[model samples]
Target chain A: MTDQNGPQLTRIQQRNRERILEGALTAFSANGFRGATIDQIAEEAGLSKPNVLYYFGSKDEIHKTLLTALLDLWLAPMLSLDPDGEPLDEVLRYVSTKLDMSRDFPRESRLFAYEVLQGAPHLSEILGGRLRDLVDETVAVLTGWIDEGRLAKVDPHHLIFSIWALTQHYADFEVQVRAVLGPGHDPYAEAQVFLENLFRRMLAT
Target chain B: MTDQNGPQLTRIQQRNRERILEGALTAFSANGFRGATIDQIAEEAGLSKPNVLYYFGSKDEIHKTLLTALLDLWLAPMLSLDPDGEPLDEVLRYVSTKLDMSRDFPRESRLFAYEVLQGAPHLSEILGGRLRDLVDETVAVLTGWIDEGRLAKVDPHHLIFSIWALTQHYADFEVQVRAVLGPGHDPYAEAQVFLENLFRRMLAT
Candidate 1:
């Protein structure tokens, strides 16, 4: 997709815009939508306030862009759940990808978590449209698997919720997780094995 | 225990203090710690800022009191895990109580979620000491059950973490849960049955 100002933006402008977004992601994930400020985001980006504003127009624009981008990345794993693949294997692969995201992109997980916790005011429309559509499509595929006796009967939606809750827990609540697991504990490794055992038993037809 | 200023407070003072804490829970849960303010808390409590301050020295005092109280409540479910009872029953009962808390006290859940997401700055001490101790004791009981072949062999710590992750997700991400589940859906009712089935199969000896 071409940018609305495609022809006008120089290479430097595009680079600076990406820089500001990276900075905003860090600041917003740490401070939340209400707590984060434009000044703090500018400092994080290593750009002056004027420069930050010149690219993004306002703090809200920067935040909406960051969240929109993050949502796309977050949903890619689920969208990759192929109907042609073995049902349980496909679901487990999706789970693995989600856990990898938690490990590799914790800031993004917390940012989404914070938004959802705050009633999803910033992303309600997107949640209702894109997110809802994706989930509905996935649920249909899971339901078809169950109907063919390819997997055990269960609410596909709730199963999806469980996968999300279980994987994302390691990232969004890292402090509590680390405190409980103690120092030097590897949670992702344990989680991978545990969840596989769980879903295997759960999906055994 | 006496108040720092001595124990001469009237009944009204105690009631007013409780009101302030309740108000703070709503504000803090919605906006998180840094985003919330004394003026907002005071307004939510229907008290003047000076009056709210008179009862609690500062916003920090109010926050500390709220957190300490919530920690006690949060730990109560874990503390109720009985060693002498049927091991699986005890665990399921603990799950039920946690789900009940999520349904009844979602704000408390979000407040804790926010604190943990922010590295648990206000909760680190309690999480490290009180929470760690309780989990250790519970893990021992679970280990005992596994040793006796009364339950399936699993890492007791990871099992406990899964319980927390699964149960709390309903509360911490209520909006997303509701949105996906759609209108007229009773998530708690569905969750209760779903969890029971998952744990029953997982724990079958």
Candidate 2:
């Protein structure tokens, strides 16, 4: 657990850290925070458990690291919701971006999903503070749009929730979705069009 | 596990069964299926482990019973999405019903959420077969409404997913939701109006 380098990880150290995080994500995503183990993550990362601990200190540390990293990525789309852009277009683009992340980074999505499912026990502080603050700011931006007559009058908070729920459905329920849609169906394509139409209609004055 | 009463449970038997299932639901919802234990459910139900097993044979059996019961209740609203009724009104009713379930039966909702989160490992057959079959039938009803120009054209599958995600969001993310909405905010009332507007707009031709 000693940081001999003291705040300066070497290039190789950075690579190893990334490797450990990547493996931890996969393990944690599959088995969840409570179900996943240090051994499994270490094995997945192709490192000894002691070496994994050497870099991350403990299981909780690794989980917290992955969670913080995932939160940053997950909130990026919402953070990009442009106040100056066309309201419906901005909302639709945000939905599209979230769906794309679901497809591209399902593990991260599931890991976040699992954490939230367990009542956000591990990340309650982050949820209450950082996440809530960001949502409040975004809601203000959305309210501004509605006031400017760029978007239909709607509860901005619920609108954001709708966007989040619809986009994340494809990733979180991929197994059931794939089964029902059949192998030929493209959920992302269908989702993009469906969400655009949904928000457009919802926001149309 | 034997039905000595022949074709129906006695009042006492039914009482015990309900107690066990309710306790199991609470434990499973909190800790998840794999994380839960029969002994814990037994203790929660205030019955000996052997007595709990007497009603439900095994942990798998207890889980299956709870899940099957939940599936029935969960699908009741969707099943009632009447082709005979006005399209938008019917869908709105369904949305409200689902949101109400999330508020009143959050433990049941969370149990199912956990099961689906874990890939529905034990209920894949139910999800893939019975669940998909029901969705197909519901999709046909929606398609008929669209074909008749009673509702706006949209992908039925994605529409179903949207309904599910929005309604279930209150239960699955209750912690974050409650925190963000503040202690006094009524999520159900807000959800009811929000969903009504959301689906109404989405389905309006």
Candidate 3:
């Protein structure tokens, strides 16, 4: 079977591919998939359009590759939700990891935000397949915790949605957050404490 | 003082302006402000480019007008949070109203989402001024509730943030929600119940 991770490449190929993706992310995140052009991406990458095309077949291909890589990294914390571990702790840890991702990778967060806001036309398949699988697995674990009386009973899907909404709000709505918070206000630090308290209150049996 | 809303128009001009705004919402919501063009909006509105320009001075004006109108409606629920009302009930009512807005005005929600995700270049002033003012007023009422032991104590700002995050998620990330919930799943109905339970639990004394 072909690897979902992508085919093997030489170090030079990998480096060039990384450069192209970096540029594409900037373009796509700023202008979105339709507004962004291959020429703009090549200029951002400091490569010729032909050279960029040599590494990735088309704009769609580059976007798919970037999305695949991003979703993998983005979903890592959720995927690591250990069924055998303390349920609330696993959930809280996932929250912290996701908050950190938003802080560290705001561009990636915006890229995904842009895609989803545009109805996720490009991501429906992956969302339906890979994302759904991961969520279903994690939801089963959360439901098991509730059944065992280890956590408060809540809709597993909505609980996960709450976590995502709360954490990603900081990144996806950064402008609104900052504007409302005013100058010099640190939102993420406040968010961490607030979210910890929120989930504790939300999940404690 | 010059009207921030718009100049007065004849009835026909007013009807045409409304049509333009409706079409602009669809175009801007679909492609974001930068990606969308006046020509596309004109075509969407079934107006000539010159006719579209006659109603609104420029593309920025159309976007600004749309955003201005949207924020007014968007903030209405928050503005209605009654200081004299039962605290938890007021909060839950606001939640329900916001969720209803999301379901009924998904395009408006996505338009705002697209702007905020791109750093709210057009909305920073309004967010800082009107939104912050309204939020501050609402927070004072919530703080009063907490002080009176009418509601569980929480960071008022983050509490507001949580409400916005959860309700707007149904609109902004609808594709992801629908994909995971599978075919024929009704997210908003389920979300209304889930959010009510969530806030009740979090806010219970």
Q: Which candidate is the best by DockQ?
A: 1
Candidate 2, A7-110: lDDT as tens digits = 79889888889889999999888878878889999999999999999999889999988888777778989899888888888988898899999999999888
User: Poorest 10 consecutive residues of model 3 chain B by lDDT?
Assistant: B1-10
Backbone clash pairs for candidate 3 read none
Model 3, residue B50: distance off in Å is 3.3
Candidate 1 overall Cα lDDT vs. reference? 0.89
What tens-digit string does per-residue lDDT give for candidate 1 at B1-205? 2244667768999789888999999999998988899999999999999999999998888888888877878878999988899988988888888988999999999999998998888889878888988999999999999999998888888899888988999999999998887789999999998888778778878
lDDT of 2 by residue, B162-203 (tens): 888999988888887877766778887998898899899889
RMSD of each: 1.9, 2.9, 2.4
B38 Cα displacement, candidate 2 (Å) = 2.9
Cα distance off (Å), candidate 1, residue A163? 0.6
- DockQ each candidate and list the results: 0.77, 0.69, 0.75
Candidate 3 lDDT, tens digit per residue, A1-205? 2135566778888788889999999999877787689999999999999999999999899998888778877888898898999988989999999999999988798889888888787898989998999899988999999999999989999999999999999988988888887787789999999898889888999
Residue B185, candidate 3: C-alpha displacement in angstroms: 1.9
- What total of clashing residue pairs does each candidate reach? 0, 0, 0
